[model samples]
Target: MQIYKVGGAVRDRLLGKPVTDIDWVVVGATTEEMLAKGFRPVGADFPVFLHPKSGEEYALARTERKNGRGYGGFIFHASPDVTLEEDLIRRDLTINAMAEDDQQNLTDPYHGQRDLEARLLRHVSPAFAEDPLRVLRVARFAARYAELGFTVAPETLELMRHLSESGELEALTAERSWKEIARALMEDQPQVFIEVLRECGALKVLMPEVDALFGVPQPEAHHPEIDTGVHTLSVLEQAALHKQPLTVRWACLLHDLGKGLTPEEEWPRHIAHEHKGLKLIKAVNERFKAPKDCQELALLVGKYHTHGHRALELKASTLLELLQSFDVYRRPQRFEEFIAACEMDARGRKGLEQRSYPQADYLRGAATAARSVAVQPLLEKGFKGPELGEAIKGERLKALKAYKEAASV
Candidate 1:
């Protein structure tokens, strides 16, 4: 039997990208033969096995039939009669269908090599429509490979549109959907994937709230055209450029989700978007089963958009009392992450007149500076005893407020 590297590892290596996982196809080998040759059986739902010596994944040549729905609704076969061409046909993308031997001899029966060389994303076979998850994968690939100038084959996009409309895409679990969506957002060009979702009409199914942002106009003083969807996309782009953490990136995308749910008549004149936006983000976060940490970031971004105005108007003692409740000044990354979201929120417009206020920069900057001097110093001092602790706390609060005000100016 001959073993060869196949799928993503090979594709990534070809593209000069880092290989994170290794996959192999064993030609002219049976599962029993593999086990006899020191491979352990590991795939119960499919025909996957692990090599005893290297522990690398090796799947025997197999074919399948749909027995259920979504990703798990399939049957597999690994027998002597199955050819590498047949096994490759079962794959989704052409570039992923190629295989390479230890000698690096390419086995590309379906022009996958050609597609990769051409920097195009194309389906392996007409059978691509049979699996619903491929739609999401195409969207993700668009994001990950947009810089490479890859375009989805028109027919494949059309098939995705059909599959999403038929509700097959909905059969996939939210966890799986979120995993793909999150990864796509992590890509350098997230807008490509998002735009693909919009083109395929899948955004409505996955995030209908976002779809409402398409044409919603904000006030002339607050924004030019102020389309909620445009603002959200801009926020996402800014977060990506700044390399914000995933949770913060998510907050940026969902921070303005409430604007879509608000009444259009309120527009520029009576915008209480921060409160409304936070509530919608909370519901969306819950639906995605986001962790408490992520939920907290979303809530903070929502909460503090209006807090700056309230803070600017408060007396020092009152403001100190209010800010003390958060302790956000103690955690700089948390505060910076919130600011990253806010900064992106503010930049999502045309001119200065469109801004909600003087931008959230002053508040975010002030908070960051305060946390750096006060919280970090206290932690570094590491003083013990009740009197020392109280002294540190008192000094920190006093220093934090002054630092914050300085940053705002």
Candidate 2:
């Protein structure tokens, strides 16, 4: 059997990127032959093996045919007769279809290297439309290579649009969809992923809450971009620029869902939108089955991002309440992430992308001051049970009040 280093390893190496994962394809190898060679079978749906020493995946050269729906509904054929060229042709993107031999000989049956030079993400064949997951994969690749000026080929985008319209995207499981969404959110240019999905209409199918924001108007004074959708993408960009965590990025994306529900008569003024957007955020969380931390943070940002923006103007009691809402004392890191999300929202507007967000520092300071209030002091005063809880709240409020007064000067 002849093994060839293939897919992402070859593609990234050609682009001068640090190759993180290396995939191998073995041609002229049957399942029995693979077992006899000491490779451990790992893939449940396909003939993929694990190298005993390196523990890297080594899949047999295989061809696939669409058998049903979604990405999982495929029949794979892996045998000694499967040719390397045949296996390469079945890959989604041309740039990911090339292979390299042990002797450093390169195989480019699909001209992946040409597309790489062109900085284009092109499909390998018309068979690319078979798996709906390719739409997400291509969008993710677009996000990954966007800094390198790579773009999806027009024809490939057409196929993605077709997949979105075919209702095949609806067949994707929440787990599979969220896996891509979460990974893409952590990319350097995650906003591009959402834009690509919106362009292909997949956003409407997979994330309609976000899709509804496009074309929706916002106050031009506050949001120079004026479009709620544009602002959302801007917030995602800001989150990425700050190297925020997935929870922060996800919260930033969903922070303005209520603005999409503004009445036409309201036009630019979405009064009470922060409270109005909570249910929609819940819908998104339920649909994606996001992690508990992500869901809670999204909801908090959705329900109180305006409060975060108006932090300095809020009453001391309200400030303490907000800090408590975030459970700042127990999970200070999560509260910090929440602050990051809020800052991204403020910086998301056009012409304000680089503006400093003093509110973040103000909130963090308030949290620190409030947390510094000693419960032991109340205990020393003989405060106990429910009364002690009330006394602690009173002291925290006092601390926040003092902090607010000091900052005002």
Candidate 3:
């Protein structure tokens, strides 16, 4: 059997990037032969084995045919007769179809190298349209390599639009869709991922809540980018630029969804949108089953991002209530992430990206001051049970009151 390094390993190497994980495609190999050679089988839908020594995945060269609908409706055929070219043709993108031999000779029958030089992400064949997952994969690749000026080919984008219009994207399971969505959010240009999906019309099908934001009006004074959708994408860009974690990025993406639901008659003024957005965020989280942290943070940011923006103006009691609502004493990290999301929102406006965001530092200082009040001192003054809890809260409020006074001075 001849083993060749395939997929992302070869693609990243060609791009002069560091290769982290290497996948191998074995030609002229059967399952029985792999087992006899001390490889461990792992794939349930196809013939994939782990190398005994290297522990890297080594999948047998195989071909697939669309058996039904969605990404999972496929039948795989792998045998000694399967050619390397045949296996490569079944892949989603041309750049991902090249393989490397032991002698370092490249087999790129699909002209992946040509596309790489052109900085284009093209499909290998018409067969690329058969899998719905390719739409997200190509968009994600666009997000990943956008800094290198990579773009999806027009014809391939047409196929993605066709797939979106063909009702196939809806067949993707939430888990499958979330996998791509989460990975794209972590990319350096997550906003590009959404842009590509919108161009292909997949955003309307997969995330209508977000899609509705397009063309929706906002106050140009606050958001020089008057479109709610444009501002949301800018927020996502800010999140990526700051290298924020996934939870903060996710919050930034969904924080303005309520603005999409605002009445057109109320254009440019979503007076109570922060409260209006909480249910929408909940629905999106429920649809994708986002991680508990992601769901909770999204809700908090959606419902109280305005409060974070108004940090300096809020009354000391109101600020204390907000801090207690976040339960910062128990989960400070979540509170920090909330501040990050708010900062992204504030700085996402057009021509205002470099503006200062003192609200973040101010709120952090308030939390620090409130927490510095000693519960031991209150207890030593004969405060007991519920009374002790009240005394501690009173001291904490006094600390915040003093902090607010000092900051004003």
Candidate 4:
């Protein structure tokens, strides 16, 4: 049996990128043979094994046929007769279809190297449209290589659009969809992921809440971009620029979704969009089954991002209430993430990216000062139970009040 290093390992190496994982395709190998050679069986759907020494994944060279609809409706054939070229041709992207032999000989039956040099993302074959998941995969690759000046081939994008309209995307499970989306959000140019999805019409199918924001108008004075959709993408970009975590980035993406629901008579003004967006955010979370931390943060940012923007002007009681709402003393990290999401929103507007967001520091300082109030001191004064809780709240309010007064000077 001949083993060839395939997929991402070879692709990244050709592009002078740091290869983090290596996947191997065993040609002319059977399941029985792999087991005899000490490879441990691990694949549930097909013939995949883990190397006894390196523990890296080694999938038998296999070919797939589209048996029905959606991603799971596929039948894979793996045998000693399956050719390396056949396995390579079945891959999604041309760049990911090339393989390398142990002797360092490269095989490029699909010209993946040529596409790589041209910085184009082209499909491997006509079967590319068979799997609906490829639409998300292609968008994710675009996001990964966007900074490298890579663009999806026009013909491939047409196939993606076809897939979006084919009603096949509806069959995709929430877990699978969320897996791709969460990965895309962590990419360097996650905005490209959203843009590509919107271009191929998948955004409306998978994330209509976000899609609805495109034509929605916002106050031009505050948002030079003036398009809610454009601003949302900008916020995602800003979140990446700040190197924020996934929760922060997800919150940034969903922060302005309520504007899409604003009445046409309201035009550029969305007076209560923050509160209005909560339902949409909940819908997205329910649809994707997003992680609890991600959903919780998104909900908070959706309900109170405007409050963050107007933090300095808020009454001391309002500010204290906001702190209590987040439970800042117990979970300071979530508050920090909320502040980062808000900062991204504030800077996302056109011509306002570099502007200072003093609200972040002001709110952070408030949290710190409020957290510094000692519960032990209140208890030391014979305050107990309900009285102890009340005394602690009073002291925290006083500290926040003092902080606000000091900041005003």
Candidate 5:
């Protein structure tokens, strides 16, 4: 059996990128042979094993036939007779289809290297349309390598548009879709992911709430971009530029969804969009079965991002209520994440990216000062039960009031 390094390991190496993981394809190898040689079986869908010593995955060279619809409707064939070229042709992108042998000999039956040099993301074959997941995968690769000047080939994008209209995307499970989306959000140019999806119409199918924002108008004075959809993408870009975590990024993506639901008569003024966006955010979270922390943070940002933007102007009682709503004393990290999301939103507008967001520091300081109020002191003064809680709230409010008073000067 001949083992060759394949897929992303070879692709990234060719691009002079840091390869994080290595995957191998074992040609002319059988499952029985792999077991006899001490490789541990790990693949559930096909013949895949782990090296006994290295623990890296070793999948047998295989080919697939589209048996029905969607990504899962496929029958995979793996045998000693399967050629490396056959396995490579079945891959999604040409850039990912090349392989390398142990002797450092490179195989490029599909011109992956040529496409790589051209900085184009072309499909391996016309059969690329068979799997709906490739649409998301292509968009993700675009996001990951966009800094390197890579773009999806026009023909491949046409195929993606066809797949989006094919009703096959509906076959994707929430878990699978969320997996790709979450990964894309963590990429360096996550806004491109959304843009690609929109270009191919997948955004309407997969994330209509976000899709609806595209033509929606925003006040040009506040959002120089004027388009709600453009503003949302800008926010995502800002979150990525800030190197914010996934929770913060996710919040930025969903923060303005409610603006899309505003009445046409309202035009640019979405007076209560913050409160209106809560259900949309919850629906998205429930649909994706997103992690609790991500969903919670998205909800918080959706419901109260405006409050954060208006931090300095809010009444001391309102500011204290907001802090209590976030349970800032117990969940300070989440509060910090909320502030970061709000900052991304404030800066997301056109021509406002570099503008200062003093609201973030002001709110953070308020949270800190409120948390500094000593509950022990109130309890030590013989305050009990409801009285203790009331006394602590009073002291925390006084602290926030003092902080606000000091900031005003």
Candidate 6:
């Protein structure tokens, strides 16, 4: 029973990153051999076994081929002949190609250690084009390792371009694509991924709606950049600088999605971009299979685009009523995320030659105050079950409509 530690765990350990999960490659061991060795068989489609004591995964050496279309449309081959070297060759990047034996001996056939040291993301094999998903992986790794000063190899970039243009990505499942994108967003420099995807033409196929933002001009009163994509990327950069939640980051990325469609030919042009964005966000959410919360947050950001923070100067009761108008618990954290996105959106326009948005502090303060009272105090009021329901939906909203009525009564 031969066991070798493989993949991310070893790479992350070498890189000083926390290794959360461990995967092992078991050579000279069959599924039956694994079972006999006290490992429990778990994987249904693939030959993966779990160690009874350690709970680490030990997978049989396997190879794959594109049998049908997308990422999942592959036929896996697991046999004794499949070597560790073969598995490493199928990897998308050289940095991820290193494997360590059970004794912690490095077995890097592709010079992955050299590439890792050089901060380069080079493909291990020319077979990269066979799987369209590798393009997204390259972009994701680029984003994740950008802080490491890594750059994608030129030939790998060419391969990505060819795969993206070949329409092979369309065959990939939305879930897989989005999962990678979500990971990319969590990376240090998501804009690098966006830029790389755009270069390879994959961004067009996956996010045509977002791609439409390219070259679309905003009002001269606002952004100096000609396109909504530029504005959106700027907003993303601002959010990254703040290191806010993922939902907020996502909102910033999509806040100006509607701007591409807004008319800007007239002087005071680009009217009602918020409403237009709300409609478009629905389609965008569906395209990416975004969760309900993400959809609602996008919609709220779009709806409140022109609302501003003017309402916050009112009395506490008045502010409570204003916040109550929206069902908070129905989509908890939606408003907070919206506020974050809007803050980034505003800050993105701060230094433009003729910016339109107001300073962000006013909006941020109002949202922060509203959140503090609306959620915490309401919870403190001993409001539970039907009572909490009334607070979130009825009283909270009623407080806004008739502040005097609710307070005086």
Which RMSD does model 2 reach against the true structure?
1.0
Q: Give lDDT for model 5.
A: 0.94
Clashing pairs in 6: 321-399, 321-400, 324-396, 324-397
Give the root-mean-square deviation of each candidate in angstroms: 4.7, 1.0, 1.1, 0.9, 1.0, 5.7
Task: Output the better candidate (3/4) by TM-score.
Answer: 4
List, residue by residue over 1-409, the lDDT tens digit for candidate 3.
Answer: 9999999999999999999999999999899999999999997999999999989999999999999999999999999999999999999889999999998899999999999999999999999889999999999999999999999999999999999999999889889999999999999999999999999999999889999999998888888889999999999999999999999999999998998889889998998998998999999998888999999999999999999999999999999999999988888988999999999999999999999999999999999998888888777889999999888788889999999999999
Score candidate 1 by TM-score against the native: 0.83
How many clashing pairs per prediction, in order? 1, 0, 0, 0, 0, 4
Candidate 1 structure quality by residue, lDDT tens digits, 1-409: 8788999988888899999999998878877898898888896886688888889999988898888788778888888778888899999999999899999898888888788888888999887888887888999898888888888888888888888898887788778877887888898878677778888888887778777777877666656646767767776776777677788878777776767866766764436677777767877787777777788888877766445445455444554554454566566567656656766666666663234544355555445544454445556677557866676557756765686566458
Model 5 segments more than 4 A misplaced: none
Cα lDDT listed for each candidate: 0.75, 0.93, 0.94, 0.95, 0.94, 0.73
lDDT (Cα, tens digit) per residue for candidate 4, span 1-409: 9999999999999999999999999999999999999999996889999999999999999999989888899999999999999999999999999999988799999999999999999999999999999999999999999999999999999999999999999999999999999999999999999999999999999999999999898989889999999999999999999999999999999998899999999898998899999999999999999999999999999999989999999988999999999999999999999999999999999999999999999999999999999887777789998988888899999999999999999
lDDT of 3 at 229: 93
The candidate 2 region of ten consecutive residues with least summed lDDT is 29-38
Name the weakest run of 10 consecutive residues (lDDT summed) in model 6: 353-362
How far residue 278's Cα lies from its native spot in candidate 6, in Å, is 2.5
Candidate 5 C-alpha lDDT tens digits along 178-294:
999999999999999999999999999999999999999987888889999999999999999999999999999999889889999999899899889999999999999899999
Candidate 4 error regions (>4 Å): none
Clashes of 6: 4
**Per-residue C-alpha lDDT of model 6 across residues 1-409, encoded as one tens digit per residue:** 5678887888888889899998888876677778888999886888998889999888998888867776777788888878888877877787788889768899999998888888888898887888899999999888888888888888889999999888899988778887888888777778788878888889888887678787777665666664677777777777777787777777767776666776546423567677777777888788778777666677777666455433434554545543554444344456556666766777676375234444244434444443443656778888888778667655444434454344336
Q: Which candidate should be chosen as best, given lDDT against the real structure?
A: 4
Residue 348 deviation, candidate 5, in Å?
Answer: 1.0
TM-score of 3: 0.98
Shift in Å, residue 210, candidate 2: 0.7
